[model samples]
Target: MGEGAWSCQQSPAILLAMPAQPASSLPNGVVQSEATARALIDAVVSNELSAFRQGPLSPAELAAQTQQPVYRALRCIRKWEKMGVLRVHSVHKRAGRPIRRYALSAPSFFIPAQVLPLEDVAGIVSRPLEQQLHAHVAHALREVVGLQGSEVFLEPRRYGAFLVSAPGQVWDGSGENLPVLANRWATLKLSYADACAMRDELDEVFARYADRAGPQTYWLHLRLVPETSKA
Candidate 1:
């Protein structure tokens, strides 16, 4: 996605809902300058996409959803609209200006994955093709773990299925050795069939938002490594 990928955004903001509040309840910290558009985009991509698609942000919803001023939020919405991620789903013709409802053209905004080739990579450099793949995975794992730290989830399967998400929440995975390593990382070893299911879900989600992040927005880091080894 290059450097400018993270700053992109959508318009007709539906995912965020500001709650009904008296004028006094409006956040004093509303985004001041247009320069803060990057922050609005960041918040939308990182946390609001799932919610926005459901409906438009009512005046009440806007106050409840974001601290940015309504205009600033609108700015982000217009930007996203320009990016082509959001589109008109409906229009509420009020007494005054028409209220337009927007929907996401896609579910997710994709953040580019970074693959750093390790210097003097062990296990991979001199190993057979099969072993080299293992080494490659292991090396990639280390890099992902080192960067994401707490964000990199690893839970054991004996506890239950790790890929399962609750209700509308997604982004779930766990590993067997996770219990052993309080601060370490491990793979979410699913049965081959189960692994395939998780892979499909991830691919779906990844495809949805893979290209939404703008140029200046902070990137969300994600990596999935699966293992077929028996317990």
Candidate 2:
């Protein structure tokens, strides 16, 4: 192996002790920026449960796999933990030092599993406005084109920029904690709250985007998902 090549596995302490690697090894499409990398890490953690399902991968493993710094990975993980998106399992003794493993707290009771994975959703947010608009319009076209799919979209005129959200799946609980939602004129990220909150938020935004509640009108599909097909 070349100097840059990493061993398949190592103790947490040993892994941490090794120098940081350059960003070149990340998956082809990964963004090179740290801010972007942090978001990518969030996307990764949100969609896939921790590797063992017992808890999240060790901090070392995350850094190794993502090629991000240990502190950077931990920072993003900590934020999600605060948002109740994840939880830390008990600290363990590894390489004779304390190692903390994190894990998803619960299947975001907020969105259903069938909804598009968060990585896909994040991909949508990370795109340029023109691209986002194009993607949104394309989704609406699906119904016209006879394609089977669901999409979440938003138009933010008063807020200065339009927001669109689309998902690959529309399972139950998909709307919870969504990054973009608007009602009439107000907007906010989806939160853990009453269904009335969701309706109020959606309705208010729709009033602005859609002239009326009728079908022909256009309103952002904040969280449209198809029911899971029972196999």
Candidate 3:
């Protein structure tokens, strides 16, 4: 841990705080984005409820986890309710006030692009592509290979990268947040929404590079995996 470097010295339950995503009125599955897909995939794979279901959560409960304003949380709750994705689990009169608790009708009721854990084994299963990213990446790799006498991949150190992790973990979310040596691998923990924005922004950067007329090639690789797994 050098100066300004972050060390994973926090708890596993230490959550990543985020501002509310301005509760939207769209129906489930209507406003699909990579973030939504990622969250859905995460929830399914975890076999656990999302923060939204930290036990029949009220808007306040959701707000607590999301760090969203209470009003925004209420808007999101109402939207899901109207979509019939959530059901009133119970209502109680507490200290002269009524409180409502809502539960997801089914885990899959509102999730987008779901694949059951049993059906989602990456190496053992072959999934049909939902888009062209895989095909295009393969095409690009072949084209790079065919070009003769190219300096595209010279200086291996410029492209050097590796993983650092405990043997049984996908990632330690508690990893450092402060700036560190750029020469080392960077570990990040981001909310689904933030992750989505990073993906889109990076795509834009790559698009700009593709439009340039020169041959200064680069390779960037990233892998995202969950934090915990085991028997």
| RMSD (Å) of each candidate, 1 decimal | 18.2, 19.9, 18.2
Tens-digit per-residue lDDT, 134-217, candidate 2: 566666444342234445434452223323232443233234333232233433444446544666665577446543445453
Cα lDDT over the full model 1: 0.42
Candidate with better lDDT, 1 vs 3: 3
TM of each candidate vs. truth = 0.31, 0.30, 0.31
- What lDDT score belongs to each candidate, Candidate 1 first? 0.42, 0.43, 0.44
Runs off by more than 4 Å, candidate 3: 1-49, 94-97, 110-150, 153-231
| Model 1 bad stretches (over 4 Å) | 1-45, 58-60, 107-181, 185-231
lDDT of 2: 0.43
lDDT of 3 by residue, 38-64 (tens): 443333333223565445787788788
lDDT of 3: 0.44
Off by over 4 Å in 2: 1-55, 94-97, 111-231
Q: Backbone clash tally for model 1?
A: 37
